[model samples]
Target: MLQKMSSVQPFQFEPEHEISEDENIEDVQYQINQNEDDRKVYEVRVGQNGWCLCGYCLPMLTGKESVCCKELQFFAVAVPDIPCITAHTSFEAVCLNRDVLWAALVSLHDRESADLSYRYASYRQFTWWMHVIRIRNIYSEPDGIYAGFEDVDIDYTEIDQAWRDW
Candidate 1:
């Protein structure tokens, strides 16, 4: 269990019609919605292997007069703690910041690629103790999912040399 954050709420997935692992996952239709301010709650349907849910696309940059040029599918997944190298696929095991994690999965469009294309970092996340961390990349490999992060301590953020090096 995790302590509640200021604006985020923690939730668990309890399927109304729980099914066994041997059963088809498509049959398990369950969605857990949280408050509008709470983006942590999410929906997860059990699959044959475990969690095979794909993420959704980012908010499209609509209209001809849109501020941004292109609509990018940017997404991220936050966890209660750093995940083990081997347990990447089993995100639920470690606990997930559902909405963001789901968004990240949706961006992949059902592909299993680990490389991300966008250059500029769109989001920043903190660890369990609230240490600021810069999300470098979140991608999937043959083994499972991985989140690359850079610790942004005072030295890194304050020192000019450290900033350039990082």
Candidate 2:
């Protein structure tokens, strides 16, 4: 009789320090900002133990036709804070509110580049999504919609015509 070998290893998880319990929200935000400022590239330590299951991993394990493969047990770390917006099986996409996304963009723009940095496409995609969400009022209720920074500007066409005449 031939014996089947299973290569699946025990899942190991490393617990991350909770960021929300800190006394001041500003302090926590500052720490997040500082961490972003100090690092060049963010590392996603998948399958290293304590990291959360990204959208891809979650559905693969729990979906109707779950596979019993060892490779499926591994985890991955992609760009930190850029939610997995791409998994096909997921029912809903994670949406960050406009203010939060804008703040993140502003912070990213203001920070000096570290050795590790997010890919240009990823940053652009997130910013574009945030802009779309702001225009659509995806986060707020019917009467409580928030206006984005761009709404404050006057139309450039009038200025262009005046400058042309001058």
**Predicted model with the maximum TM-score:** 2
Q: Can you tell me which runs of candidate 2 are displaced by over 4 Å?
A: 1-15, 18-88, 91-110, 114-130, 133-137, 147-166
Per-residue lDDT of 43-151 in model 1, one digit per residue for the tens? Answer: 2221121221232222322322221111211111233232232244444433465866765554334223443322112333324224322221222266655544665
Best by lDDT: 2
Give per-residue lDDT, candidate 1, residue 138.
24
User: Which whole-number lDDT from 0 to 100 does residue 131 have in model 1?
Assistant: 39
Q: Specify the poorest-scoring 10-residue window by lDDT in model 1.
A: 67-76
Query: Candidates' lDDT values, in order?
Result: 0.33, 0.40
lDDT of 2 by residue, 1-166 (tens): 4222232111122234566554688888888888775442223332232233443433222222232222232223222333443432221211234754565455445324552245544564676776766535534567766554332123453334444443
By TM-score, how accurate is candidate 1? 0.15
